[model samples]
Target: MNQWLIVPVAIPAMIAAVLVLAMRTSMTTQRAISVAATAAQLAAAIGLFVLASDGESRAYFLGHWPAPFGIVLVLDRLSATMLLLTSVVASGVVLAAIREWDTRGRHFHALFQFQLLGINGAFLTGDVFNLFVFFEVLLIASYGLMLHGGGPRRLKAGFHYVAINLIGSTVFLFAVGTIYAVTGTLNMADLAVKVPQVAAGNEALLSAGALLLFTVFAIKSAMVPLHWWLAPTYGSTSPAAAALFALMTKVGAYSIIRVYTLIFGADAGALAGIAQPWILTLAVVTLIMGTIGVLAARSLPDLICYSLIASMGTLLIAVGLASAEGLAAALYYAVQSTVTSSALFLLAGLIARGGEGRAPPLPHGTLVIGLYFLLAIASVGMPPLAGFLGKLLILDAARTSAHIAVAWSAILITSLLLILGFARFGIQTFWNRPRSDGAAVQPLPFALTAVIAGMVAALAALSVFAGPMMDNMTAMAEQLIATQGYIRAVLPPAATAGLVGG
Candidate 1:
């Protein structure tokens, strides 16, 4: 087991406890501690990413117990990629919050750290049961962050967010219980071994359990019918929290990819590739509807929320392909979208500071306009930006699919719709500004501008490094699909070889 595999989860857990119990009173100390911890997380994630590049899947078992009997944390190309992404985004959000958003509520820093714990935990956990535990941990912390500033509107939205997630939690438990009953194990690698050997008599029960888990991830991913919760929930939260919440939905998407590719993949006997049929159809609808939402949005925040939904639509379409090509595209797109969307949210916070209604002229308005221009074209997947490359890769990967025409048509049409929607918002926000009545134009603080600009710069860096990044993602997808390697990393060969009749 690699020792550093535990750093992502353990460091955040320790720091969060300290913030609550040790630095409870001093906001300055809290800020310092949170930033230090986030920096450490980023450093650790970078090291792990480099280590994982060698194509090895590693596991760290809790209490030194072997798999199928104790909790285990697995790290591989997929998890390592996500860990690095989460750390980068979290580091930016913490800095963004420090300027103003942190002072809005008590324990904001604490909740922030806890959510990191959950997000990182979800990525690192190798057992289905512990994944659910991390899901709840993140959700619980998000509840506090969602309602941080405290208003009637925020409170109302937070209630709906909490209620639906509670339902998701209930369904998740039911799924876990059903799976455990059938396979007699919750460790994912164990399931990878046992799921293929499940008796025909029990296939239906196992399929039901698997679909139920998909439902939970779908809701978390904000897929179609379940996507309604996002606009209201995100629209009401503060920008800093909303920026961080960007990964919350991605976790659901991640779980779907991880579980389906491992347990119910092509080798799973009668239950092979079950999610294959539904992924494309729902993804097309999600793309169309989400872009339409972007077109119809009345506020900057609403537009961003809907745009995120639309981006997820684009992402899942790639994932649904289930080929090395498609999965690789999905991985690349996921990284760009996360960074782009978080940056957009932070920019929205800057715009929102101008107060309600049409945007008013402010100091450094020219620079803000320039940032919006770059992000808008990127968001709409225009030329030379990372988003454009991501979509192009997805389109190229779809060529071998049975649904090629449909996939191509939906993506092409929605790209136009997204362009129109973002164009309208850009004109409205930067061009059709309200008349100023000699209002003092206070310049944006240096720290806030630096953080948002840094995020935008990361997107540019992604574009520049697309060749190497796509190559890496292709390998990661291959790594993800090879269940034998992943299983061996968790369970000994003797244990796996003896599981012929498990």
Candidate 2:
């Protein structure tokens, strides 16, 4: 049962390799294999979630190798939640891709599976080095997926995306090297024990390395100053690709929460709260910028991308609080944003149909308009949707913070701005603009529409289940704050003594 921890990463890798070997075969075969593999992964993820949700953490050391010396995969509530989220979104994206996007180019199924492999690996790995390795794997897969449909727009965006991430990766390597030099271990649990014990002379060096590592996550999370690459990169990609890319940002958020709380929490002596001020300021700025971008967006895709930035901003605000309440809210909001953003991206594609400006009204214009409205409400945090509850929780979590007023003001104003922006978009696209003349419009495929509707239903269900979900999130947050569980799960008892330089 413990070995099943690796199944999420392993199954996709095996499927991707098989797909590559049979590359010459029909896409039907590839699609069948890819979908089946993802389904199995989702099941595995669900199982992991159930096991970990009880406030217990589990770790698997590969080949029975000792902890810190061999690769280890740890599944706590946080990782399990992330894995489940990835699999759910991947499942939806895969269904949408099958509706024509899969055949647009060669190796779509293979790349997609590899992308999942990387994402799952990132979520499960218990070591800094393998985390970086998984980042590269997912990124390499994304570069291909981003250019799947192939156009000057996509090529240009992909170039910028690759270039920016390459820089981030280089910085990540340097940060890892610095930490390894300081602590003599790359295992996160060991780092938790060792980081605080770093000699006084190395304090500044440790802090700098940790900050540099966070800079990488900041870029990935699209935090204000480092966020420019997101809009263009996500905006120009194929809708299916963009929809799947939704979880990519959360990967950064997850890494930030996981590492910061585990390795640099209040226990980390001098490093404690070092990142708090910067993260809070960045989160505020990100919220403001994302709202402005949404208001200024000229296309549905751009709106969705900017909305993603804003959602990240909201998620980060909770993260900045650095408390159990805040982390719980952050986890809840993380799920809401991931699902909402992915749904909107997928819907934006069907509505836009790859054209510019606004998506022209198809024959089923009313239904499309309705779907847009539902997603827009969810995105803007209006009532009866998960977004509203998420915002409320974040605000409540930050009630004692010095910047509570500012957080509330930003969230409220941004919500209104988002509502107005999406309203204008709907009016222009559905009411004001005439249909494109001399163009043939095909009704969206049942599978495609079904996928979108399914996501909307999921959002509704998230609202319905918010109570129990938040309970789980609260439990998860508590487990995270008590880092001893994670540490014990990853490091052997005798080896643990070495955490303090003994």
Candidate 3:
């Protein structure tokens, strides 16, 4: 009877369907529905967070069937956190989109709601197969949003994005099939129990399964080599779309934390032996490359995109450490990066709008320049900001895990790159006298400014609450590392190998 677990996923989906009915007749009605749906989702998310804080895990079996045979939805602290973050970001992006609403706004709202549905479902689902379904839901909605205006550039980027993710989804399907074939269950909790029992002789199969799953997640998270599609895709999309994309990438990062720690702990640790070193090495490479990309970038949006890539690498490096502290840092950084990056992207949009949608040939006024400097400093991990706190945590984790050299090197090099890149952007956009064409710039909308300001305030609040936040993260990390907490929450005690009936 604990239906609260289902409300977050179902409300958005139902509202999306309702929007389709009203799409042809009343645009105002559709917009209201969209905003109301997101608000409802936000409310549900807050409620779930309160429930989760009480340390209860709620599981709902579809059709009232039990465990392995039936699909399940599970809610825990991590899922609740993700749902809350997703709702807040989605609501912000939706509200921001209202400033630029077009005739297609109905479709846009529908897609946004559906996308949230996918994201929430992915976080809540107890079945791996359902995760794939939810991922596809997210992708399909994203495809529409990415190409919503249907420009040549967006279409081109959308093509590449969709094609690459489709392939990733195919591989995901194969991995699911393999896991099911070997373990005979797609429920994550069931597989968490069954997978380790895979015959020793068939360890190779399980490893391959794990690796395939890792690859799918890697591409989703935009880890180094698999990150080719991100910069362009984000750069081409609208700021609202880009903000949503920022949250989407974290879903993959969340999966890495959730699945690797919960379901494939021993396998992940073993894979870490082979994979962790390479991930660390590539994390350094990605950090340097992304920083360099930012420095050399011609536009603010591109700079933000590349910065995001670099941040993702940093989080992955934390994940590679496979320690409780490392995981906590990664989680902390994931939340921090999402808020900061999205805010920066919105700032870039505001900048472009101020310049009349064209890049200024030279810098503007000193006041504008000063604001740019502050934002740039914050993005580059200046002290007392959220980024600084996150980077410090990551560096501490890496050092404690004995990756001292890699840790220090990554911190130093990335800091230098960020500073240099932002310096260049600040100089170009603000320091020098504006070109003849740089007449008085228009002010950005109050709503947009308010949203960005709210994000910055939230980040500051997070810093102030760091003590309690880190405590929760540390406890969650301990629970994850122990694994038994998750295992017992998801599966019943009697369930075991080979074809256990639900």
Candidate 4:
């Protein structure tokens, strides 16, 4: 009723556009607007979460047209949860960047706001074309954000980032074009209804389209084979930029769940015989590859980046299993990983500051060492943490679905690789003595530490209340897998209310 969905996406865009003009006159005002805009978006997201928990899903049809003919914005449980997570993490990173903000830059605040606008837009939009538009919007802003300070390394990374994404965009466009060709619509809700009606033989075309689309998403999500770009690009970027990039990949993973479950779920014959099975296979490979990357990487940022790859793999496994519980596990872990991985990267930045312009070498001081151990334990899914709960749910889901071999193997292999990876890094950095000429250990910023601490606390809270959280996530996952709930939420009252309830 409140139309709060629009605020999270549109308010930032409006503020960013105005800031572009105001930036030339008042840098302080621009900074204030940027911070305030993010904070407001965070509040709006929380409101949406409350609405979602009450079983309210809102849909806005652009230009006053109804679904199937016009673009729409739909917010259900999944979207609401993702929006809240994105807002919280984005706010933390933006706040952390306060010390690093460049008041003199022409587009600093403008780009940051626009980047957030794109992210929120992606999370809220109900149309496929709009997703592409938001992705580009985010990427264009990211290009600037990555090179904001204009160093050689940043420039190099930006070039690869832009080039790879340009290719991804092309693939994305091709996939969308094919989907529209077959379904005659780009609205995801509409496509969800129309895609199953496609001819059997033409199913090949749909599969091809889905595969192409998945490829683009896998690249963005940093799935193993397509993940080469992430470490170098993210590793070279500034800490604030890297923190933002950390969450951006989840957008891709989220799309994977959204599209596969909503539009492709009805085509179980096709998906089960080909797409889902292949995805499951890839998930295993991705998990192994990512873990190896972590074990071998010497740099802390690179290790964190590879750890992100591992998390992405874990999510893929859940999605590939295609059960309600599996999806809930994926969603739960997705949130946990986003929070923990970002915190780890921020901590790495803090540690690096204490080094010779690199991540603090292994064997850090006692205080730093303890924190690293805690983070490593969390990242690798040690018991009594949110990560462990998510992993346990995933294993249970896999086992219940009768994929016992894959389930047990995934659990065992992932646990071993994660533990070993972290152990190697922990020993190298914290347990070993500091290098003789390494930079003096600068006091980590309280803001950064506070964020990490908050993430840890959230992880612990989620674990403590795992039962309720799992129940909610299970409900959300059931609705998502059914697709009817989302479609009903997006359609006009006459079309959906009687069928799905208002």
Candidate 5:
């Protein structure tokens, strides 16, 4: 079980190859294998999550290679949490796609598995270079998924998506190269140990590299100004793909949290928190713009896409607080919002009319409407759901920050905007529209409904067990802030000294 750190990546990689090479023509076979692999992944992730709950960081050196030199997968509370989230989302997304979405195009099942491989690898890798490699893996797979249910709109959006990511990839390589050249290592643990000791002459160079790294991550996370690619891309993609993609941005957020805390953390001397100053300010702007986009949206997919951005804004604010409480809050919110975003995207597929531009609402009868309202309330951070609880944690964390007023104002005001946006869309979707006479109304598919209910149920469980979840998150945050534990866990004993020195 200790070696199962690679399960998240290996399971997907192996199955994806099998699906591509052998099961390409058999939809039935592909569906069966893909579903089984995803369930295996979920089970493995759960095992890893329980293992990580002990709070000690563990490293799995690949091919028996030592840390800071060869490939490694490190499992800590954060990585374990993300792995679980990815596996959970993949299970639901695959289930949703099996019915009709995967049949829309060739290789969707393979692409989806590859997407999971990339996402899981991104979360688990201990090397910065491998992180970039996983990023490419996921991005390439996403291109195919984005165009799975092809349309002229998807083609156009996919092109922009590809082009934007290509630029980000190029920047990512440059940043990795710069960091390696300066620090003499690409391993995150090694970098953490070495960053604090950088010579004064190299401080500026390292700072530039660090900031450049954040730039790439910000692009991947869909931060504002760079967020132009998200709405168009997500809105055009199929709902199942879009739902899975909700985890992709978290890859970026996870990278930001990981590198900033471990490598450029408070102990990094001159390089301490190089990316900190930009996070909160940009997060606020991001939330505001996303809120505006949500209100301006004319279609369900488009609206949900913007709302996803707003949720990112809120999540990042907790992250930018640069405190243990903030990290805990951000982690909690990340889980909640990820599920809520997926739920809304799936709901969009069921409820919206099929066509381009300003997709008028198609009545989805009772079940879908009920799910939509439930998700909408959850998405808008209304009470009694995990979304609301996550936001409250964020606000409480922000209370101690010097930027308390700004954080509160931004969160509270944008929350109102989110509610208004969801309300406006909901009224048009469920309330004001008149159903045609003598028209046959199709009931929602039980499978899709069940998949969605599972996600909602996860959110409900988070709310129901909010205390225990937050307690774990707090311990995880403590582990994150105490960088020495990670440094010791990954590196040889002799190497850990002086690297984590504050």
Candidate 6:
């Protein structure tokens, strides 16, 4: 077992514990510790990604315990990529938060670190039960973070967020329970071996379990009908907290790719293609709703929230295809969407901080408007940014699918709507806005500005290196479709002998 596999989770857990115990009263100390810890986590995640890119799958068994019997953490290209995404987004959000949000409430740093611990753990865990555990951990921390700013709006939104996720969590447990009841194993690798061997009579029950599990992920991903909670919850939270949450939807997307591909993919006999049609129909609806939401948005934060929904809809188009090309494209879009959405969230906070009612013209009017234009272009899938490339990949991948016309038309039309809508927003909020009456023109925090700018620069770099990035995503997608290497790495040969014998 490689030691580096656990570093992403362990480092954050340790740092969070220290902050809670020793530095809760020291905002400066908490900020310094958090920044250093996130930077280190980013380093670890990058190292894991490099190793995974070499096409080898690695699994770490806790306390030297073997798979199906003990806790296991696996690092493959997809999971590694998610880890890297989380760490990078976290670093920027932490910097933005430390400027002011961190000092506004108790244990902000501690909760933030714990949140990372849950997210990283979710990415690495190999068992369904532990995935649920990590989900709870992250949710608990998020509950605290959502309420950190202490406004009536924040409290109201936080309550809804908590209630909805609690319900989702309950559903998740039931899904896991159903899976375990039928498969007799919760370890994902073990499930890959056991699912195909399920008795013919039990196939329906197993499929139900899988679909139930997907519903939990869909809610987390904010799929329509299940997506209504997102805009209000995210729109009302403090900017830094909401920005950090930009990666949360990807966690749901990631889980769908992992579980769906590994356990219920083409190799799973009766279960193969069970979810394809459902996902496709749901994805189209999701896309439409996202566009509608954007058109209806009353404020900048609300617009970005709708844009995130649209982005997730775009990502699911690839997932619905359930092919190597489709999954690869989805993965690419996932990265681009996560980073861009987070940057927009932070930028929105900077533009108008305290209340969402209206932003008095910012002191750095030119800079704020400039950043808004860049983010708007990037988020709406304009050319030369990663968002454009992401949509192109999805479009190209969708061309061979039966729904090509629908996918192309929806994406293109929505892109236009988004551009028009954002243009209107830009005019009202920045160009034609009334100046603040007697308001102080405080300069934007240097750290906050630098972090947002860095995110934009990173987006540019991703575009410049699109070819190599897509190549890696293609490999990761191939790995996802082929589960043999992943299963072999987690379970012993004898444990899978029955699966192979079949």
Q: For candidate 5, lDDT tens digit of each residue in 1-502?
A: 5588888899999999999999877889999999999999999999999999999899998998888889889999999999999999889988977775888889988999999999999999999999999999999999999999799999999999999999999999899989988999999988987888899999998998999999999998999889999999999999999999999989999999999999998888899988887988999999999999999999899999999999999999999999999999999999999999998888777665333323443444576677888898899899888999999999999998998998999999999988998888877766765553435445456677788889899989999999999999999999999988888888888887655243
| TM-score of model 2 vs. true structure | 0.97
lDDT winner between candidates 2 and 3: 2
**True-vs-predicted CA distance for residue 229, candidate 2, Å:** 0.8
Question: Taking the tens digit of each residue's C-alpha lDDT, what string does model 3 give over 1-502?
Answer: 4678999888988888887765657767777888888999999999888888766567887787878788899887788888988998887777777756335334888888888989999999989899999999998988888777777888889999999999999999998888788778888877777766678766677778877888898888887788889888888877788888898888888887777776786533233233456557777777777887898888888898888888888888888788889888888888878988888877776666645233453233443454466567667778777778888898888887778787778877888878888887776665454554646545457776667777777778878888888887776677667655555666666653232222
Worst-scoring 10-residue span by lDDT in model 5: 353-362
Q: Any runs in candidate 1 off by more than 4 Å, and if so which?
A: 435-438, 498-502
- Tens-digit lDDT track of model 1 for 101-130: 999889999999999999999999999999
Give the per-residue Cα lDDT of candidate 1 at 82.
Answer: 96
Model 6 Cα shift for residue 463 (angstroms)? 0.5
Name the TM-score of candidate 4: 0.92
Model 3: lDDT to the true structure:
0.78
- Which candidate, 4 or 6, has the higher lDDT? 6
Worst 10 residues of 6 by lDDT: 353-362
lDDT of 2 at 309: 98
TM-score of each: 0.98, 0.97, 0.92, 0.92, 0.97, 0.97
Clashing residue pairs found in predicted model 5: none
lDDT of 4 by residue, 196-219 (tens): 667887778887888888888888
What are the clashing pairs of model 4?
362-428, 362-429, 362-430, 363-429, 363-430, 363-431, 363-432, 364-430
lDDT of each: 0.90, 0.90, 0.78, 0.80, 0.89, 0.88
TM-score of 3: 0.92
Error of 4 at 55 (Å): 2.8
lDDT for model 4: 0.80
Superposed by TM-score, candidate 4 places the C-alpha of residue 198 at a distance from the truth, in angstroms, of 1.7
